[model samples]
Target: MAADDGVVLDEGAVVLEDAPPSNLDKLENSPPSNLDKFLKRFRALNPHFVRDDAEKLVCFFGDSDISHWKELPRVRITGDEGASWARCVNVGVGGAEMLHVAFYSAECRAKYRPDVVVLCAGENDLGAGAAPPTVFSYLEKSIAAFGHLDDATEQAQLRLRHDPQRTRDNANVVSSLPIDDTKSQQQDGMNASEFSRLRNNNTDEKVPIVYLCTKPEPVADAELRREYERYDGRIKELFQRYNSSCQEELLYFIDNSDLRDPSLYAQDGLHLSRQGYQVWDARVRDAVERVLLKMDERVLAP
Candidate 1:
């Protein structure tokens, strides 16, 4: 959660803002987007995803769990001798709710029609009191929002135009607050060529989307854990129906039953410690490898 302090620290991120220390004075609301500050920091840290080689990228979107799994990409790429197999980018933002997932990955989603997109959200959404149906609605919105490659472009535009819950605390920050203005604001202008090319090449491409079921963590109470279970059940039930009908598999549901044990989590009770991360890393790697292998077989077939 954001606070009066100038430093916004998540389990894996520390975002600094140049604001007055005194909340006794007039308060300054954060930018309208839940992901504004985090995105700024990410862009500064990893500009190459947008600028340089992002071939065979597997982009992950979630909260701190994904963000905190900072080594997943590098460790694999190192083993593969510097991404000969694939590269990765983690666009997870700590404290991000379910609704924020798609928007957080929109740029990469648009730019690199990644070989795979893995989503690891929903626990935070449920913990925040959203019903299972509501959390699922956010997932549905994300799935629909990126049905086509062009939809990613539209999502970026829509983000600029509309931010939900804007009427209450929406105050324009000073121009000096560059973090408030998205990198999208600076980069959307150069995107005409990129998008135009994407529009032509991928008019009908259906990218694979993987939804990693919500994990039971220590932060949520018993009722919240139950809600997490309900959300996961809803996800499994709905995707099973979708998978059964579709000839070509586009949606995948990965279960997290192995992660139910409390010992897997760190002492903080939110993030996964090394032991828990071992489980998470395996889940992510297995999903990515399966997607890549499927792609390889298709390309090599007569």
Candidate 2:
């Protein structure tokens, strides 16, 4: 349970703003035309079925934090030197972990044919009591699953976008193991170090680039906070390894733990507030620009 300040709503309901009628009931009762427009916009923001004709397609895959990107106003993607660039597509699903993200990655590659994919996961696996090796394996597998596919199969999947009846499977694999709320705090920092060493030695590159976001520290009960801090530390360490690894500049990590200000969090202390989403949008835009610049530079160098 979150603190009183956290955003709390009934199951199957989403709070778009800090006001009345935050439930889906209002949407359900709206006129057909209004509902059609709303659904169209929602589908546009979350393009799981069809692919837009954007020159540069970027897909964001993760949990609630990634899903919240839809709440932010669109921002121009200016490169590192302020030259405008590409737009992004959000394929986030709340409560998703690496397993779910991996599945979605395949779908995004086949349908959207994204030029870049941002993966934000692992924290939930850590919170769910997954061992460090297990977590690392999941991350590696997810990245690998996004690797190049056969041309014919890829084209077939891409053509499916034209089929109006084509639908996406939303099922996810859930772990039944009880969460170890305090287990992270009990371990020495050695696990993070080992994970970092293993990750750096792999020198793996699965896609053009995989933008990873470090887990933010949770602002909840004392026990949960401690565990989150430990998990966050591991993420930072893993990011450092990613930077030092000899792989191509195909994996970039962004640290967003600083955005943990109380005012930026909803009552649940898990999701972001509207203001928080704005801040996140700015950071993500900057990172995307940097990546685009690097890609351009690499292309022009030869």
Candidate 3:
């Protein structure tokens, strides 16, 4: 059965009968051992803290969910064994679109001077009924802004010339636009091929990475399920174009679309659950590690 809020419920509460148990649950249920207490204290004192000797600085720019996720990417990366050497700065603004994200990223870059920028926005733009060109243009502008390219002059010219190389050199990693089950119509505003063209046309040197987080399957609402079925193929096609066009070194695609497990999602069915964010955290951490390793190699080559 479903709740008045449209959340699927089994008996009295929302439950995940078919999903595997999450590690978070184990941590929650187990008594706090000495080591667990120590770790908990350490995390409480400095949840988003990075060591002074950290190798790289990562900045995240995205929507409200990115800002408020149970574990922000920065905190997750800081705690990761492989990625602990990196520092993180999160500048995610709730309810932001590509345009707002670009502006904030530019501001954050000036202050933090991050070596890597991860973008997890654009859904709001689609929700707002923006056209494909409009959405793409905002993305381009945001990329340029974060790269420290002069916005007023460069953004105008970029639309005409559309230099993909400039963006590629900026050390930006953009997450692909995910499919939202709630939206009946296409949220991306553009078709897959056109989106592909816009993205490919702007590339050149291939240093920046594109991370694709696939949408979840099995939306509970029948109406929403129908909507997802209609758009899922096109979303997959867009992701394919992004992955196929880029060198393996420059693209990191996380295919969660086949994930039908309701436990991975929040009550809304649109956002990710704590477990889902954990999945994202691991993938993004790996991608950032690869980028940092490649960068280190480049620096040491000379």
Among these predictions, the greatest TM-score belongs to 1
Q: Considering lDDT, where higher is better, how would the candidates rank from best to worst?
A: 1, 2, 3
Model 3, residue 145: distance off in Å is 2.0
lDDT of 2 by residue, 123-176 (tens): 554454444334444455455456532222221111001122323221110112
Give the true-structure RMSD of model 1.
13.5
- Residue 258, candidate 3: how far off, in angstroms? 3.4
Please give the lDDT score for candidate 3.
Answer: 0.45
In candidate 1, which residue pairs clash?
none
Instruction: Please give the RMSD to the true structure for each candidate, in Å.
Output: 13.5, 14.5, 14.8
Tell me the whole-model lDDT of each prediction, alpha carbons only: 0.54, 0.48, 0.45
Model 1 lDDT tens row, 131-209? 5554565565566555533444432221122223323111111111122235425533223354342231332455677
* Per-residue accuracy of model 3 over 20-81 as CA lDDT, tens digit each: 11222332355223323322322233245543434567766566546656455543233235
Question: What's the TM-score of every candidate structure?
Answer: 0.64, 0.58, 0.53
